[model samples]
Each structure stands twice: as C-alpha cells, then as structure tokens.
Target: MTPSPILDLAGLTLEVNHLGRGVRFYSQVLGLELRRHDEAAGVAEFTVNPHQTLTLWQPITRQANDERLAPLRPRGASHLHYAWQIDPAQLEPSKALLDAHGLEWQEINLGTDDRPDPTLYFFDPFGHGLELRGVNRDDARQPHFPPTPVQRPAHALPVMGLREVALAFGDYAAMKERLPRAYGFAYAKEQEDRDFAQFTLGPQAEPDGNGTPRRWLYAWDPQVGLADMLGGDHALVRFYADVDAVAGQVDAAGLLSVRDEQGLAVRDPEGHVFEFVPA
Candidate 1:
C-alpha cells in the first residue's frame, strides 16, 4: 500500500464543436458552474467540484496551429463516454432534469442487492454519452475533502462531480499496459480474457468509502457491448502528479509523449490523451 503521486482526476476536456450550445447545455441542463472561458482559444471551464473540472473546448484550427499551442495541440474528442457522480437520493430526480429538457435517457442497474451500481444514462446536446453514476452509501462517512458549495442553475442535474471516464479504443492491449506502468494505476476489476479493464489511482473507487477520493478511467473495446457509442470513442483525461515522474516513466516505457511549457502529455494507442501536470 504505497502512496500514489497521481493526486486526483484533475479534469476532462471534451470536444465542443459549438462553444455556445455546449456551454448552455452543460450550464443550464447539467448545472455545472462556469468558472473560466477564453473566447479566443474557444475554451470554457466549468466547476465540477473542488478537485475536479469539466472543460469544453471548440477546436480552433488556427489557434492550435499557433506556435505556442501546436507543440501540445491540447484538444478533446467527440462522442466520448464519461460519467458524473450523484447521490442515490438525487438519482430519480436527475431523470426529471433530462425529461424536462426533452432529452431522452435510460436508467440501468449494474449491481445486485449486496452492491447496487445504479446509474442514469443520457446525452448532452453535442452527443457525448454521459452517465450519472450513483454513490450508494448505506451509512454516513467522513469525506476525503471538505465539500465546496457551488451555485448551480435550477435545471441542473444533481451531479456531485466527475465520477468516471470510460474510453473505448481498438488498442486496449497497449493502453492496458501503458496506464499502470506509466501512471501508477492499479487494477480495480477486469473480465475473463476480456478487452475491458478498470484501473483505480486513488484509495477507494468512490465517495462512499473513507480514504482519499477516487477517480476512474475505464478502458474498453467496442465489443464490450455498449448500447450506443454515439459514433466516436476517445477522451483527454488529465491528472495532477509529478510531471518529472510521469515524463520519466514515459521515457522508460518508450511511450510517444509530448512535453512542452505546459507539462507532459501523451496520446494513447486509441487516440485517448492523458495529460500530466504539477500537483
């Protein structure tokens, strides 16, 4: 049980083709508070929680080709599969938020009586497959960090924060090896000789447990049987860690990664990008 330098699931950057429509859906529909926006860069930041952020970036071809951004080329993919954390009490109400806005959604149970993984699934205006993963807690426990009060719009879903980011790629084999060897992620769960895997960087996998907060990165191939992938699969997942350490491992593992004025970044075999910055 050694300590993990990968501090937290820092943020997620999504490919928001239209900045205004994407921002409106997340703000008015999901209730994420707007934190920062650089119109010139076509980027908008929303406060998901004290430790996590959800960013919407409209790819600026000219800006990305600029001398400064070209090296990193920071961008996100469309139709990425990701999840948001919410309490069980707020689960049913979340469906209402989707229906009230004329958005179609589905609810599913991935667990049994002993461990019920209740989830609400839906899509944003831009078609990113979003899931409201429930935090099923039977007893009260101390949280890893103090809760921050964020003022959200009335139409917002009762989302706690970014819970899980699931990426589907063809090169699951390479990513399965790359995630742990380079980033210190340990296996949480995996199926029999399967293409899907779960890796946990923090103590517990959710707010239900006591230690540090948990952030999830799920890697799976298309054959994993997703109802709908929304015609694309990939993500830009960020983490706060020792950049030197991440860079060191990237070299040791012989991973093709980018290091610039920002920090260390890498695109995986299936196009999902991982960015490592200073803690």
Candidate 2:
C-alpha cells in the first residue's frame, strides 16, 4: 500500500535526562511556552509554533534496560544538536537573557555565500549545542524557492519552521530506500559522492486547501566529525505541525529510540540515524 502523504515538517522530540531541569532551561533561555505535561507518562511538551512541539520524556523505571538510558561509561551515545532561527531584533535580548541566567554561549559569525548571513551558537543546560540564525528580512519575505504552493492556517503566529535535517549513516543507500517505504517521501534529488539527498513529502492537493505536503533534506557527511565538533551523531529538523503525527511516522519506520523514554534514535537498514519529529 502507498504511504500517507506527509502533512508538513513536524517538530522534534528529545529524551532529556531531567524533565524538570530541561523544561526550566528551555523556557527561560528560548522563551518557549509549556503546552502540555503528563507526569504519569513522564512527558512534557513545549511549543515553538502553532503546530510544532518539543517533547521531553523522562526515563521510565520499567525501561531502564534500554540502551537510551545506558550508563555513560565507555562509548556512550551523545545528545542531539538543534538549530533555531530568530528575528535579528530578538538576538540581543535573547542573548541577554542567557547571560543573566549565567548561561555560557559562543557568538559565531557564519560566513555564508549570501549576504547578511551569520549564526550564533550556544549550549542548553544539558550541553546540547544550538545554533541561532538571524533571518534576513529580504530572504524571509522573498518568495519561496521552487515556488511550491502554501496554505496559511487560520490563526497565524510566530513559530519556528523546519528547514532541513542532516542524517549520518554508516551505509547511505539502505537508509535512503527505507524512507520512501515507511514515509511518503518521494525521491527529489541527490548529490554525488557528497552522500547527500533531498526528499519531498506533502499532501497531494494544492496550497489553498489543507493537503499541502512538506519538504525535507537528508544529508550524510561521513567526513564531518561530530565528536570533536558538536558532540552528537547528527541533527533532525522538523517544521511546524502536530507532534503526534510526526511521532507516528517514527513508530512506523521502526527506528530504534535513541533515548530511553520519548525519542527514537533508530538507524535504518542502511545504518543511517533517522531523527523523526513533528513539523
């Protein structure tokens, strides 16, 4: 059977070591609002956009044997890194907030091929690397590239949209094949030898209605070192959408959960780590 078309890029979920601590850090530093929490489920969710949510699941005692909660001794897995975009005007205020909270951050000027391109880097309380990009008004207001149809929701508000995601795989080809099989991602394009590929997912209808599909880019760079750089395997990006739907796909893919509670850090048949989230 054909897979259901992806509604849009959803948000990502993480399994944090301490749910309360993570919630405090993200809310204060990122200005996120807590949308939902279930102590019984050991889950807490934060909203970055209307449809996007960042979920934090605490380790359940019953599932302690899962590798996601394995003791960090020798060769333990690392936390995931995330990138967020913010308006240029909010950069200083946001940075100030972090400083007042005694949070250490690294200001980075990313040199891009385009004009007005710079990004700042910082770590969360848990030492997860994060990038804050200043959106170029010209670029943000400019028409979308490839000019695909877009349908605006009724109640529009500021939210973080998913841009792209990077995947690291020991075997690239196998991971590529499983994506289309599990998710409704169509083969869009591929870069030779660079081990990079792009996939498109969306509703089959036009932009005016509720059936618009989303786009995703999957990248694999074996040469890139995560340990010496950001201290993670790869990054998973999700756009604005429902959290449950995104999680559904992750479950369908049968990828192994990287975390003990909420997040899955499953490697596909090709040995690529796929980070699934709500868009």
Candidate 3:
C-alpha cells in the first residue's frame, strides 16, 4: 500500500512584538510581498514564496471598560531564524545591499561537498535572524526549483522564498531517527561541524501545486545558547496536508501525538512542536 502524502509547507507563522516593524522589515529589507494585514485582528501575512505564507501577528491586550482600545504588547518568538533562497548570482549584490543599508551580516559555508553554499545571515529590525542562502548552483538529490519572483527594493536581490528552516534541539539521535520515518519526508542532504549537525528533509517525489522546494532542517547542538531565542510557545511551522488521510497516516505511524481542533501536534526529541493542519 502507498503511504499518505505530506504535500507542501503551506504556512509558517511567526509571533512578533510589533506588527508594523515586522511588516516593514519583511517588505522592505527582505523584499517579500505584503499579502494582507488586519490591524484589528493583529496579524499581517506576506507571500514568502509562490503559495507559501509567513504571518506576523502582534498581541493586543484589551481592557474590560475600554473595549475599543487595545495596546500593542510583546508576544510570539523573539530570535527565531529562517533562511530564504536566493539566486547564486545575487550573492555579492546581496552583500553589497546589506552594507549599503548599514546592516551587519555574517557569512558561513554550509555545503556538504567541497563547494560550499555560501549563506549570509543577518537580523531584521525586529531582531529575527534571516538568512539568504545561495543555492542556485547547488544540486539537490530530489531537485524541485521553481522560478518565483517578487517585487523587491531597487537594486536589492530578489527573494525566491523560504528554502529551509532550522529547528534546534538538545537531543539529536532520537529525533534524527524518528522524524523522517514518521513524516514520510525523505532525507535530502546533511552537513555538520563541531557546533551542530544539520539535516534536510523533503518529499520522495517532487512536490506538486505551486511546488517550490522547502527544507526541514533538524539541528542538534547542546552547547549552543540562544537556541530558543527566536521561537517560544507560539512559534509554529504549520504544514498543509491532505486532511482525509493525514490523521490516518499519523495513527498508522504509531507515534505519540495529540489531536486537537488544530489537527495533529507532534514534538521532536528535544520538544520542538509542529502541527499538521488540513489543507
């Protein structure tokens, strides 16, 4: 029998203290298109990829007597880090653009083979670490690259949307063994060093529907501080799955999971939460 399919990474919701600041940074600095923003609802959504959405929501505290007025309060993850894919040709221009804006960025080699995929890591105005990975030339074992472009700042590098997200953990061995088996996601690539080990996850077959490739990176590092800086109780990565079969798949996998109104919630070895929502 064939296994249930985990179609695509449809959404990644991030909590932000200030919705306006988050919007400005992602729209201006990162060059993502602003899809919609509801001030009353306290949420702003952006088109990170073709069909992929990244939402920034601010917490609003309301008083009983003065119900009409609410103040912006701190909520969501503070220092969560995620990477956006950029054309390899734009690597130098991206560096130049960051320098022109007086933003400080650091470079690192994260490729498995000799030629490293050069990545530029920097923080947004709201303190969220954003990475621009030059993976145009890097070959994928299960290749799925689509040419999706967005209106960006003048002379700024165009973002191809989110390519990978890193989930840090204290325990590695157990998560490394179980996640792939449970989710039906294939191991695409991996790279490691003294500090941490990073493994990429993808579907066995090339994904369909607005099908841009995405990577689920499981990172293991014990001595690393600030691993939880960007994410907290509300920081979530939500995937769009076939609702009919997903629950059955989860049950068949025989993994311990909690089923709530939001769908199935599963935790990694070190307690990183992920939810599979109905598509």
Candidate 4:
C-alpha cells in the first residue's frame, strides 16, 4: 500500500468579510504581529506560529487580483474554528488582556479519562471561533512540536503556537479511515458517543524535542444548531500539504472528487469540503 504523504500541518487562511475588523482583533487584541497589510490587494498576513501563519483576505467582491496564484472559489467570510496553544502560566494574563479589551469568552473542559486541560473559547469580530488552551506538559492527548517563535507585543501574554483544529463531519468512518491513509497523520486519541464522537490526528513521534505535534479533530454528529460552523457556505478549513501526492493517493483510493486551480478538493462522505494545497 502507498503510505500517506508526510503531511506537515502548515497553517490556515481565513476569508473574512471585514478585513479591517479582523486584522485589528487578531493583531491588537490577539497580540499577534501584523506581518504585512496590502490595502490594494485587500489582504493581510499575521505570523501566528513560528512556521505557521494565518492569512486574512477581504471579501471576494473587492478583489481585483490576489497574491495567491489561484483564485479561491466559494470564498467569502469564513466561519472557521481554530485553537492556539498557550503556556499554563500565561492563562491568567490572557484573561486580563481579554477583560481589558472587554472581549467576552467562555470556558470549555475537554476532559479525558486522566484529566482535563483548561480551555477558553471566544469569537473574533466576524464570529469565527477561536480558542486558547492551556498547554499541559504531562497530557498525552496533546502533540509535542518544536516551539514556534512569536514576536510578543509589549505587555501582552505570549501566544505560543497552534494547538488544534476542529472539523465537523457527518460520515465519521470515512474521514477516520481516509485521512490517515492519505496523510501521514497517526490516530492518537478518541472519544465515542452515539450522538457525538471525536478523533485526534498528528504525526507519530517519540518526543522529537520540538514540543508537540499539531493536533486536529474530526468530529461527527455535531451538536444541534452548530451546523453553520460545520458545513455552511462559509464553513471551510484548509491545510498546507503536498497536493499532487495527495491527489495521487486520492485517485488510487477512488476518493478524488474535484480538482481545481486552488488545489485538489475532496468531499468527505458527509459532503464536507477539505482542500489540500501545495506546501
């Protein structure tokens, strides 16, 4: 069998309706450095992790041309959910920052059999779900990747690295089986429920000394009233991977669904769109 490609979780690109508001919240409120802002192109880039980045692009209606070689289809404001990792000690200070800015947030406890890591969930100005999770050094549920160097704005708690990304799915078995077969993600942890189930994915390693592996979630039977965030017009999550290689395997597995200028787009059994673009 052809093994899944050595897929490295690069970063994410967000298509936001309000570029100015999104940029301000991510840079000033989230404390990430604004790497670049191109008013003419209507796009902005922010360095979220050392190797990972988050690109914010204005609504397609205003786009004359974009730096990205390919035109992103079905692109507009995104209702995406992504998480960032933070040192445990930085949690209180993070609260202080959010409180000072008057940003509202709620807590989530993703408990495992052993223990639970503290998590704070909030939304960006455009209602994209964002999370700050306390890094648990002892938790096996997390991945250990090399620390990404972030330029911390003065007086703001340091944002460490990308933690986890959650994707909602209707056909759990296909996503569970196909992702590992196509990407080099090894199944790590799982929680099963008749109505809700979760699977974690990452590169298998013996503590590479980097820190933790980037974590991803494939969730099935999403909670009621959250379908918009899962599989709506603006619902999408993109990953940086070797598109050609992935396409090759997808063809081999008879899973190749769509090929476009943007990259190889595949629809999971549940009809969720996942794009793999050139790294």
Candidate 5:
C-alpha cells in the first residue's frame, strides 16, 4: 500500500442552529477556550487538545456567499457524531460534571474484548451527538503527545484530543473506493461486520502493535444519525494532508474538486464536504 500523506485531522465543523446556545454549551459547559468568534459570520472556534479545533458555525441563510467561506459557507453537519479522548481517571467525574450541567449521558465500552475503552455518550444543545471516551494519557498514539494539563473543577472534562468523526453513508461502496483513493486512508485492523467500516489515518506509531491511530473517520449505517440522508449536506471535515497529491488523486479518480489558496475541497457522492490543506 502507498503511504497516506494525511498528517492529522486538523478540525471538524458542525452546524449549530443557534450560535449563542452552541457557544455557551462549548465554552461555559465544556470549558473549551473560545479562541475566536466572528459574530458577523456567526462562527466560533474552540481549541481542542494540543493541536486541534472544534468549530461551530451557524450559517446565515441570506448571506451564505461570504467571500471567506464562499462556495462552501461555514455550514456544518447536523446530528453527526464525533468522539473526544479524555483521561480515564475522570470517567466518573465526567459523568458527574454532565449531571451537574443537567446533561444526560450513557456509558458503553468501545474497545476490543481484551481492551476496554469506557465511553460516555451525550448530545450537545443542537442535537449533535458527542462522546467522551475514557482514555489514559499514556495511551496517546504519539508518545510525544503528553497528558493534557488539567485545570481542576473549572475544566473538569479535559478532552485529551479529537479521536473520531462518525458519518452515515447512504452509499458505502462509492465512499470506500474514493476516500482512500483521494486521502490514502486504510481499512482498520478488524471489521465490525460488513456494513460498517472505519478508515484510520495519522501517526501509525505502533501500526504493528496494539496501538490505534488517533484519527478515525467512521462510515456506517444511516440509522445511527437522524440527518443522514442520501447526501450529507450539513457537514465539513478538513484535514492537514498533501493537498497537491490529494487533489491529483481526487482528479485521477474522476471526482469533482475545487482548489483555492488554503487547499482543495471536494464533495463526495453522499454530499459530504471534505477539504485538504497543506500540512
């Protein structure tokens, strides 16, 4: 197999129906530092982990053609799902924090039979499903990636980093053929049946060992997400990869692509928007 130039999943964008409520939930409730907020454009950015971001943009229907985000305005995916890695030491504490905020959540093990990764499932105010998977700091795929600096009660649910973004595909075959071809992701070590497949990317630190990649794009059945339709018109996933090479692969595969100063953007058969920028 050829090497995938995907350095990392730089950011994931989710559409928020209400910018104020979304901002409050992420900043006040989740404790993520509000790095930037463009009130005019209704866009907010939150810092995640050592080098990642969680962006919420409430697209302005009338002025959706803003130059900065033209063609693909800041609109994000709805009812889409993603996961954040958190310190296992704070599992119960995370649950308690959710309770304190009156946020209902459920726990499930999302690991192998031998390895158990306790995960908490919950929803943000905009109905975006989120997960707080219990993880050890050392379990970071990249050892250089250290444990997150804790901040006691204020930042109780310290998210180690963004781990996975799950999407429901109306047509899995086309995605399986194009995603890896354009971005160079590979099938996971094992299969969770045939209908669902996860493409792994970034830092293969222990590819030959039990270590898992930090970036995961899960393509699964439609029943998991409500907004899942034949085309995913609401989400945008961007990555730090070899944009030129990715663009080449994308074109070679006969997929439609649009390039700009920042990077390349492409829409898949499912209406999923993906952007590739220089790493």
Candidate 6:
C-alpha cells in the first residue's frame, strides 16, 4: 500500500540529568520558546516552532516527593545524536552567531547522486549534531524521481521538511503498534526484522502501481556491531525545521561540535547522544 504524507515532525522527549540545566541550555542556546512548564510535575515543554515541540522531564523513578525530581547521573554512553534541517540562506549568519558564542564547527559537501548541494553540519550545546540545507519551495514540489506515472504526489509540500527519522525503543513491537494507533503513522515494511522497521509517518499515499512501497521508519539492529563498523559507538536523534532558519540559529548558539565527513556530534543537557544530518 502507498504511504501517506507525514502530518508533521513532532517534538522529542528525553530523560535529563538536570531538568533545569537542560531546559536552560535548550531555551537559551537553541532559542526554543518555552511553551509550558509544570514545576509541580517536574515537566516542561519547549516549542521549536508551531509544528515541533520538545519536552524535558526527570527520569522515571519510584521515590515520592521532590527527591524524585532530583537529577541523577547519566548511566549509559551518550552516543545518540539528532539532526535538524534549516534553510540554506541562514547558514552563514547562523555560523557567525555560533562563532560569537565561541562554539566550534566543521563544514562538508553532502553532495549525492540525487543532490549536489552543500549541507552544513554542527552540534547543539550538549553535543547533538545538526545539518542545514537549502531547499527551494519549487524544488520540494518535484515528483519523487524513479517517478510513478499513475500517482501525482502532492505539489504543495516542501522537501527537507522533516522527511523521516528513526526512534530507538526497548520494545520495538509495542512501539510499532502504538505509534501508528496514536500518531497516524502506518506500517510500511520491515527493513530487517525487529531491529529496524520502516513506517509511513506521512499521508502521501504511494501510487497503487508503484514498484516498491515508500517507507518512513528505519529501525536499528542492536545485534549488528554498529560500533565496530564505525570504529566507535554512535547514536542519533532527528529534528526538522524550516530549512531556511535552523542553521543560523544553531551557529548563533556557538555550541556546535565538529567532525569529518560523518558530521559533528553533540549531547543534550542530560547527556543523551545524537548526530545532526540534513534531510
């Protein structure tokens, strides 16, 4: 079956070591607007924009009272990374802002057979990687190449608008069923058993005759020796924004992490790992 066009990229929730410190870093350095806060509940939400919102909450605990809210030391490797897409034009200004803040960054051309433009990469205050790309409105309207004649995909949507991402979960099957029921993501196909399952987070239906169905989710295979293949351990988180504005803001924060062809790495205040890549 054809997949639907994604409704929108939602915010992410992560366990933090220090809720206040993490919130401060995300709000101040990332320029995310605080939308809501529940001190009594020890939960807060930040809006990246109208469509995306991030929430920071204390780790799950059984203790009663304020003591439960106390931040705890991170227990695992901070190898996760998240990528946010921004407008291409804002790249230099954003980079300058990061420089003003004393943050370091590295650049690379993300040219591919399908796309040959430059994509800038950097990190957040914590060390999550972010990437910015320039995608014109017209460019987003072009039909998916290796085109399907019967299906005329929506022309209004823009490319690089949070196309898709992978979310790591302990119970893959549970999430596989729960996400679609709660969020509207439809099961597309399994990339490789439970390790990685692809889902259609969008509403754009694949043409009836399309050769292979379009997939949204790419589940990770824990069994695979990913660390060994890369020579080190790594993790990922993915975020989406107006391709035009994200880079400049990231650069302005001056907390960008640098890296080689792979891209820079950064962590959230609580130490969750992530890497930024352009959509």
Candidate 4 wrongly placed segments (more than 4 Å): 1-6, 62-77, 112-116, 136-145, 155-157, 170-174, 181-185, 194-201, 205-214, 222-245, 253-279
lDDT of 4 at 265: 65
- The sequence of per-residue lDDT tens digits that candidate 2 reaches over residues 146-210 is 22212222222122443334445566676577666554455667765567656554433222101
TM-score of 1: 0.83
Q: Provide the global lDDT of candidate 3 against the true structure.
A: 0.58
lDDT of every model, 2 decimals:
0.69, 0.49, 0.58, 0.59, 0.69, 0.42
Clashes of 4: 11
Candidate achieving higher lDDT, 1 or 2: 1
lDDT tens readout by residue for model 5, 13-78: 888888888888888667877888887887888887646788887878687523644665435887
RMSD to the true structure for each prediction, in A, is 3.6, 8.9, 6.5, 5.0, 3.6, 15.1
Please provide, for model 3 over 61-119, each residue's C-alpha lDDT reduced to its tens digit, 9 standing for 90 to 100: 65221122112122344456777777777877889888876788887665645655667
Query: Candidate 3, 216: how far from true, in Å?
Result: 3.1
Arranged by TM-score, best first: 5, 1, 4, 3, 2, 6
Candidate 1 lDDT score at position 273 = 69
Highest TM-score against the true fold, candidate:
5
